[model samples]
Target: MQKNHHFSYVIGAILILAPMLAQAETKDINQTKFSKQYAGWAATIEQTESEDMLATYPASVILWAGSTFSHQYNSPRGHKFAVADASHSLRTGVAIPPGGNGKSASCWTCKTPDAPRLIKEMGEEGFSGSNFVDLGPEIKSVIYCSDCHVDGTAKLALPRPHAQNAMAKIGLPFDEQNISMQGAQTCGQCHVTYYFQPENNNKVNMPWIFGNTADAIEKYYDTRRFYEWIHPISKTPMLKARHPDFEQWSRSKHADMNVTCITCHMPTVTDKNGNDYTDHKVSGALIHFDQVCAGCHKSKAQLTATLERNKAEVDAKSRQVQNLLVKAHYEAKAAWDGGATWPMMNEGIMGIRHAQWRWDFATASHGMYAHNPKEGLALLNKAIEQVSAARDVFKQVSSQVGAAKPVYPDISTKAKAQAAIGYDEPAAVKAKQAFIKEEIDKHWHPVATTGY
Candidate 1:
């Protein structure tokens, strides 16, 4: 018993110091080293293009009411830019003031590597009480080793509470030994359609109570009477769809084939010395297509062409939904402006709500085109049907109003669109800059200099 106890003690000590010990030998490499090791693939990686899908649309359809911070509807880039992107985005940064940004410390939960430690120290309630600016100082590391690991082991763990809720809702039979599921579930920690439940508390919640489909998610939110914001002009309750990557990607061909996200996005590569390990620098599979696609597809050119074809088809359909949604919002606003009340246009309002929900589901699910193009296009068609019905309702209500035609505004750019929605872009930018300078820099700069 004494011998066994001493052996156990020695093993435990080594386990405790494993991360520190490993850092000396197998530390995460810098971008330069990474590029060299990755055969210059990292160098070709591009910053995610900045896009504002809403900027071109009318403010009535773009901006959410009662949100102090404005969100830019940009697609995510490589994980390397995680912190840089969040810190600069108006959605996360504008909410930095003591009570102004209209966001809680919970906002930082998925954005930082130190989330587990911060949550442990503050407790979930205390964390929610704090502001993004106050918590910004503590979150120095971007999404890194600590976010999903305990002492840098291959063993996976989930750090975010919302993911836990989602897994429970979906009735995912827990299996501690299933590392593949764990790896995939860990990705779900951030990559799903989620909303902050309470306005102030901001406890992350997935609309998975009903189901995971586009319609099912909308049904869940509708039953709960949840609305991210009411369209200021249209007067219809609206829900902003966040990235629904996991939901859309699940059960797709790749998923059905048991090709988890880690299998592609984090594919294992052999070093010059023939040591094999999964790459930790997560990015799009296409960025390192040779490494990922070469496992199955022989010709990279053919694979690239196939992906592009699917994406183009999906984008074309998504654009149709976007146009239809714009028309619906404007028509709905015209009806409201023409003195159409909820009592009179309840059915029409519901149509607009559900239609836009479908549109957002297809549009918001990152890489939905590649994951499941058929479903993506189908969702868009359903949205078109619903939005067309909404337009019909507006026509019916048009007889009661003075204006015969919907007054379309000249919202050609982001500024115009924001102005139409009563958004103060300058104010948001100023608040974000102030927060970064006064609060975020105190911690962000130090670690940034020392290097992530």
Candidate 2:
């Protein structure tokens, strides 16, 4: 009887809140568009495996580029954890209200379903300038059906403005794009590389004007003199490649063969009731080879062996490229400390910058080796070659200056690497906790709305 009464009370509370939740401007209270497959995946909060994922910046990253990655980085778990993880992540930082944490609102773009709604309510300018804390009250929903669904029709749409702009810049106007491309484009909306333009209140932007190729994107940044950061060790202008899955995949054989990201990651599945729907729980296709790949490759053993071989080869090349980068940074630092001027070293550092970009592009892409082995290997090889060229320049400058080789910093663990880069991880974590306890808890959840 008590349980029944509690249930009734909760239902009544929901009824009272329904009007507010279903306001004319934001009317998805029924959540009819939420995919069951996505819900199931979201519930699996322990699905934490990810390729090339690191809980913190690697030593190579610290010794070579001088990035602490905002003191935290972690493998993604599940859709359900996205908002919470982003909130607590040191990468996001403890954004104080009004001023925020120097990060843009675009950081929240992929983490919440409320983003699309917020974008609609606040114009692009308003959305771009909105503080993270300011958004806490409004954006309560995680990634959901409404984010990708077209109103009145359940068809998928790319609601992300930056992606649409990128597509348009590439002569592929999104609205006029074919229905067949919708799935990939929808995923690309968030999955592709983007940076917030500081000039425009850190508005979300992508460097797709020149093209999506590694070199082409590099060229675009070079032309604009845009850089994500400057390497503290190499003093080279640097651009960090975010997960560039769409850019790499678009150039892959699978894309040429008309394979969409959804085709693989969200393979169609049928239940015992004979209804067919695409699985919305997005992850790598390799995990569910039978569901996604068996139709193409009959022998699972052969397929697995082939994938493993490709992955091994790529992993080896990636490690080699990383080692070369570490060596190049150390050499450049030695030359610099020994009085190598910018006029003598800038060209070589630029080469290192471009090379590292390629290496990062290949390393960051999901299963690039297995997905597109040829391109993946080529990228790594190019990085190795570039590093070699940079090393030659470093040697020339060091020889001229008679500088001794710099000792590599000891950074065997994430903590040591962070310390090398001068990151206070504990302090950042504590600030996040304090923000959650005081600001977020006080403003985000109302006492009356707790039951609802």
Question: Which candidate ranks first by TM-score, i.e. highest?
Answer: 2
Candidates in order have lDDT scores of 0.70, 0.74
**Candidate 1, overall lDDT?**
0.70
> Across residues 50-139, which tens digit of lDDT does each residue of candidate 1 receive?
556555343423534445324465556655556666666777654333446555777777767676677678776667767765666676
lDDT of 2 at 43: 54
Error in Å for residue 96 of model 1: 6.4
What TM-score does candidate 2 get on C-alpha atoms?
Answer: 0.86
Pull out the clashing pairs in model 1.
95-101
Compose the digit string of candidate 2's lDDT tens values, residues 107-203. Answer: 7888776777788888776888877656766668666665676754557777878888998887777778776677788878877888878788777
Candidate 2 colliding pairs, count: 0
